[model samples]
Target: MKTTKRLDLAIQKLYTAFHNNTLNPECCKQCAVGNILDHTDAWKHLSDNHGSTTLNYIGMVNQKFGKTFNGYSPLELLHIEAQFLKACGYQLPLHHNNKKPKNPTDKEVLFLGLSAVVQFLCKLDNMPDVMDCNQLFQFQPQIKTSKALMLS
Candidate 1:
């Protein structure tokens, strides 16, 4: 399936960050949205607190002016970060004392975070989730059920 140019770029950057061990849920400049915006922490100014979906004054102004950073609105960026953090086993808002993965750089942990961000990105673009494997399972049951029904 064809993806938007922005989405494709975001995915590429995320893939690079993941492989480079730079994807960190607790770091603004290395999180999902940050990586998508080319490793910039400027997106953090869009929200009053990290991991928050609510946009602050600056974010509201940007939203009012129809501004998008790397093709993502301020609100969308915030949501993406929240999704990544949650999938990475971080407590929302990213407190130092919050529960987090034992190995923050673990491939499994990063994969989960990336999966969530990709899923959310797809949703924003009104596309089917690339990370979804339900279709693989869906066909299996249909074939088995049809054969079982025929035998019955």
Candidate 2:
């Protein structure tokens, strides 16, 4: 089980990486999925070792888009915002007057959420300390029970 302190630190690092534009947009998605996968000892080794997971995640994403991951340069994190919005069942409003600002894409919204989560995690120490691993596991059986659940 991951400690809140550790999770908080990871979130802070993630946010810093994003804000500094140091994160590869494609890699960010892979990392997010990989972090969830890391909850299981079976897959934990994949974290910090980008070879297999990066290939796999990119392959999956490419398959979804009917494109090849190979030879495709990673996009800017902001550019993929539309993809996230579509995944979340949002439709960008049509510009009738051609003067309204465009709605944020799904990918942008997702990046924002990821950034916010990281920021929120960084602030956790200031919040009331509540649950230890044992208590959290007890309350959230899904986290403790299986890798699949954690990834899902």
Candidate 3:
């Protein structure tokens, strides 16, 4: 399968799992992947309790990919957040502390997971640049739009 198709499949799987409540956040909570996915919502990154867990995922991804993120700079965290925002179809704010809209839809969560998977695949495939890594998003298919969902 093409990389885009493969990644899209993974995103769909994640979407199903999330809607089915099949993913256990416990699996990645302390690790970087877990920190971002398991912890935050659409609007926020730094939890007063969690305090910007992006660094954790950075170290983990770097370790897994044999790349180094150095984990200490706020700029590095912003960079990762940029990728995630793109994947989530969100816009980057001028202020790092600004929050996004609350009550993220299932699609949002899955796309976020897709973002992480893309990062992981990039590491695994040794294709780290944005142009290369972004191909993972070429086939991103939304299972359902908000209009189809019954909002309470």
Candidate 4:
């Protein structure tokens, strides 16, 4: 999956976060979206420097990538977070106000998650855009069965 330069950087960071097990309330509270949106690019006008909100970014995504995310929204993200957190038996810490001062829209949260997801899946499968095929992880069992197989 392709993305604008800044979004790509953000997606790559999210990819790294996943591998490093760094997804947490702190990062989410911080610039989860801002991490990429704040970058500088002379040719690009979509950066946060332009006073664009998360909704603006989402609209840009829909514009750039077509309507693949037309039906996806922030409610979907809240529910996804709730269900996944519940299944994992982890609970988000309680705060008087959980949202950050620059609270991102639900759609923005979903977009952030999705960008991470796409980069993650691409990394896992060695998709041409994000990872080298040789770097793909080789499961232990699969390694035992395949010749010249070892940890990626």
Better of 2 and 3 by TM-score: 3
Candidate 4 Cα outliers beyond 4 Å, as residue runs = 27-31, 34-152
lDDT of 1: 0.88
Q: Write the per-residue lDDT of candidate 2 for residues 28-84, one digit (tens) a residue.
A: 343332232222222222223322223245444544575411222222121222232
**What tens digits encode model 1's per-residue C-alpha lDDT throughout 38-108?**
98999999988898899999999998999999998888899999999899898878778888889887899
Better of 3 and 4 by TM-score: 3
What ranking emerges by lDDT with the best candidate at the front?
1, 3, 4, 2
Global CA lDDT of candidate 4, please?
0.37
How high is each candidate's TM-score?
Answer: 0.86, 0.27, 0.31, 0.26
Q: Candidate 3 — which pairs collide? A: 28-34, 32-57, 43-100
Best candidate (score: lDDT) = 1
User: 1-152, model 3: which lDDT tens digit per residue?
Assistant: 33454334434545555565554322223222333333334213332222233434444455456543222233343444444444444444423364543433445554564556456544444545333433567655557777787653
Clashes of 4: 1
Tell me how far the alpha carbon of residue 68 in candidate 1 is from the true structure, in angstroms, after superposition: 0.3
Which regions of candidate 1 are displaced past 4 Å?
134-152
What lDDT does the true structure give each of the candidates? 0.88, 0.36, 0.42, 0.37
Model 4, span 10-69: residue lDDT tens: 457645544554444223322233232232122122223222223346446544664422
